[model samples]
Target: MKKVLSMMMVLLLFVGMLAGCTSNTAPTETKEPEALKMGLVVSTLNNPFFVTLKDGAEAKAKEIGAELIVLDSQNDPAKELANVEDLVTKKVAAILINPTDSDAVGSAIKLANEAKIPVITLDRGANAGEVVTHIASDNVAGGKMAGKFIVDKLGGSGKAVELEGIAGTSAARDRGQGFNEAVNGTGIEVVAKQTADFDRTKGLSVMENILQAQPEINAVFAHNDEMALGALKAIEASGREIMVVGFDATDDAVKAVEEGKLAATVAQQPDKIGSLGVEMADKVLKGESVDSFVPVDLKLVTK
Candidate 1:
């Protein structure tokens, strides 16, 4: 009888121990909150300005512990569409886009809107769809600065060439408009206005052609630095002394300015634009509202 009682007590103790072990959980087993997933669609990683923009966005994402998925459109509208659709499939919390073309990006923005994902514009804006905010510099103002510099330098009389960006891009349109407005009343005559598609190679070829056709060109204003540098090379090859003004004060462009090779370049804060876009997306994800248009500052860099 003593032995049986001892066995029963041991069984009861074992049962209690089992219950305690099953009910108690380790304090270290606490769950972590999921990271917010965001998407960034760049028009092209080819340009240094856009590359810096991407780096800024990535830095912000790392600082805030958010997941950022970056995609390159390669400056193709079709590729941009494909990129947006892929992001939508992933069901990201928000999408920030630097559109290849303002008009072409409308359909891509519509996809995100249909999926109930928040959309924000980084450097460029979309004309077709709804967006929570547009973060960029005042492109028109920058263009005006470039134009006025040329006018003032030439004492209101000079022959210049305008190298345009992608035709349908907002940056191109606004920059062209502002430049034209600035030169309207002045004696600065834009002898040649051509599209180089914002590419250095195209700029080189176009400028080479123009140099052959036009004998007397005083200045050249390119929408972006890549084209400006390209035109500069062509002019150098032909040994012509012409003032070249570029936009997007990229590192190379700034260097050119410092070396007295480039007259001046309108500087836009691309990194700030990128960082601001991510910050705005974060706000929207947290149920906060943002402005319809968020404009970054711009300045002119010259030697």
Candidate 2:
């Protein structure tokens, strides 16, 4: 009986040990996910050029495993400012902006600055506020190239019309400056110059009006492909053989060039600009120093 009691006591001790082991075991702890967020504010989605820019930024964001929030400003300065505010409210890690109006975007950039969020300008730039970097092609040089092409094609003496972009934007200003600088001493007279606001429809209407006023234009220089294509349509309808030069070698513009509709275009890689902007933003967030201006290369595409 004593031996039986000893065995039972040993079994009870074993059971107690098992219970203590079970009770002392700790539950596995779960970790929270790391935060990664990016914001993209486009000036306008109506234009195919800006759409391509957005696509590049999206592709880069996906590759880097970050969440990208895209907002279309619809070419409105107020809307752009509002969108920047919304992104700030969302506490995004960084922001990439293609401003509708370079000067008007200052207020929005200031807000981002106050919130301590880094801002990178793509394609377009802000006149005021701190930007981590500005990624774009040299528009002035591109415009000069286009001007030189026009001068060469027309043998340095011809009547030309200029289709300008949005008045307040840096692109329109810089491109016009370059074109003017090149054409000044070339004897290529600019008989008419007008703003089209960078819209295809506007470009069409504006070019139509310009055509009515100046019927004997030898060449046309449009600030962007949209305007160039519009001017082309007007020229086609009028049965005129005006040499047209455009910027932004968009896909449609490229096709137009291949078909001999557009004379030439200064091809700025919107995709590269977008991707580089995101890459720079990432580096800035990682405490890396980046250049104030990152210039993408440009090529003149012609038929």
Q: What tens-digit string does per-residue lDDT give for candidate 1 at 174-290? A: 899888888998888888999999999999999999999889899999999999999999999999999999999999999999999999999998888889989999999999988
Which regions in candidate 1 have their CA more than 4 angstroms from the true location?
1-22, 25-28
Worst 10 residues of 2 by lDDT: 26-35
- lDDT, candidate 2, residue 22? 88
How close is every model to the real structure, measured as TM-score? 0.94, 0.94
RMSD of each: 2.0, 1.9
Q: Give residue 254's error in model 1 in angstroms.
A: 0.7
TM-score of candidate 2 versus the correct structure, residues matched by position = 0.94
Write the residue-wise lDDT of candidate 2 on 70-113 in tens digits: 99999999999999999999999999999999999999999999
